[model samples]
Target: MEYNTERTTLKIPEYGRNVQRMVDYCLTIEDAEHRNKVAQSIIDVIGNLNPAIRDAPDYSHKLWDHLFIMSDFKLDVDSPYPIPTAESFVGLPDEVPYPQKSRKFRHYGGVVKTMVKHAIEMEDGEEKEALIYGIAYAMKRNYLKFNKDTVSDSTILTDLDEMSEGKFKTEGIDLPHSKSFNIAPAERNTTAVRKKGNNNNSKKKKRRY
Candidate 1:
């Protein structure tokens, strides 16, 4: 008697190294609840690390490809499609005007501005006034330049002190005045000192003769 034989083959989907690692890690978790929580946490971490990934253009394409391979040509699920929204037909709205391009910079600036405003309103004194003046001074001088070498904070502070003097002036705020603020006289004296030293050297040569 002859027996009929039949054989079947299985095809496995190939995943990228990173995706394979993630899949292996997920499979290692025994409990379904814990596995889901871990997976969500991982997704959240990735989103935080690369915010651009959240609104990526090619994400749907990549997802559909992965789904197709995973289904092994058996599942009849439709390919992923872009969700229709009121804004989808229209282009993205213009970004709000802000000094710095970085979100972190804007966040920190907002916090500083709020705290300084509160301090100015609640307190009444030279120190408070100076603090407010300083804040305004900083805001006026604050700028972001790409591709430039990093400058020392001290040098930036000095530049701010010079440039923001009249620009940040506010009504009813009196900054402490210093008596020794003569730039021209100081420069003239420095020049005179050098001249006198040179004359002294000339007199020594005459005496040697």
Candidate 2:
């Protein structure tokens, strides 16, 4: 039995050693026409091995590219599609730059921070006050999302003050209504509904008697 340790390293192991062996055999064939036919056959086998991708657009082209890759681009075959280089497979993906400024409140996220910054820069007026109120409401909503437990208006105000670097003041700002965040009403309503249902069933039983 031939162990993988003794065998040559596979370029794309997903295709398996048999597919690799077929690609190696294609490289040995001197006739371009014969090699192309063999490469096509190997691609068909590869498609069968991975049936899911076979239905994808340009999958045949991808299979042909894989055939070249498996042979380390040594296989001299007439391909319908562009022959891919070893660098194409081994090339590093483009670097994605991360945000330089970290969010003070990750729960509120970058949008809330941006809103706070814009509000801080704005001239003191009804519009700025309105924007500040909007930001506060958004922050409160975000806090509730993070914690189902009701968040205090003071907590949101403190966060807004700290995030604005003391540029914004909450001294005159009346804490927004906390009714939306309060889950007690919902629980109370549920209890009331259950009690009403029981009373209705008792009334029906009395009517039946």
Candidate 3:
């Protein structure tokens, strides 16, 4: 038996050893026409093996890229799309940028801070005043949600002012009562539990005989 440890390593292991071997064989064919036919066949096999990519927008193009990748960019068959170089895909996916802005009041969450910022930028008017109050209410709600203990409306307003660099003047804004944001626990099925208990009792009595 030819152990995997003894054989050459596969470039893309998802296609398995047989597929890798087929790709290696295609590299040896001298006739350009025959080699292209065999390359297309290999791509077809790969596409069928991974049915998930069949519905993708550039499915065929992706398959051709994978074929060249598996062959280590040595496959010279005419490609339907632009030939991809090893360097183009060297780094793989780009890194996603993380939010660097630090929040002192993390308990109120980031959304509250974002709202406060937007409220600060708006032109001062009745509309801006409503938004300022809305942000304070949200801050208070978020504070109550995060911390089990109740937070005063003043504290929420103070936090809003601090986050917005005193831009949002919520000195007299009153937030809704803490009870408004209280998350109620899910109720148990008491009736079903009682029925289940009675059924168990009846089953026990019958089983005793």
What are the Cα lDDT values of the candidates?
0.37, 0.64, 0.64
As a whole number from 0 to 100, the lDDT of residue 197 in candidate 1 is 80
lDDT of 2 by residue, 55-122 (tens): 67877787777778778787777788877787777652222122223634766755456556656766
What's each prediction's TM-score?
0.20, 0.41, 0.42
Highest TM-score: which candidate?
Answer: 3
Candidate 2 minimal-lDDT segment of 10 residues: 92-101
RMSD of 3: 24.5
Runs in model 3 lying further than 4 Å from the true structure: 91-209
Cα TM-score of candidate 3? 0.42
User: What are the runs in model 1 whose C-alpha is more than 4 Å off?
Assistant: 1-19, 56-209
Candidate order by decreasing lDDT: 3, 2, 1
lDDT of 1 by residue, 126-208 (tens): 43454455444333323211111233444434433443343333554332222221224334345456657866998787522
For candidate 3, write residues 1-209 as lDDT tens digits.
23324557766666654457568878988889878866876775566555565677877887887788778888888888988889868753222122223536865654455456555766777656755776676677556545556778877776777788887767678777877764332111333355468669987785331
| List of clashing residue pairs for candidate 1 | none
Could you tell which candidate, 1 or 2, scores higher by lDDT?
2
Give the local distance difference test score of model 1.
0.37
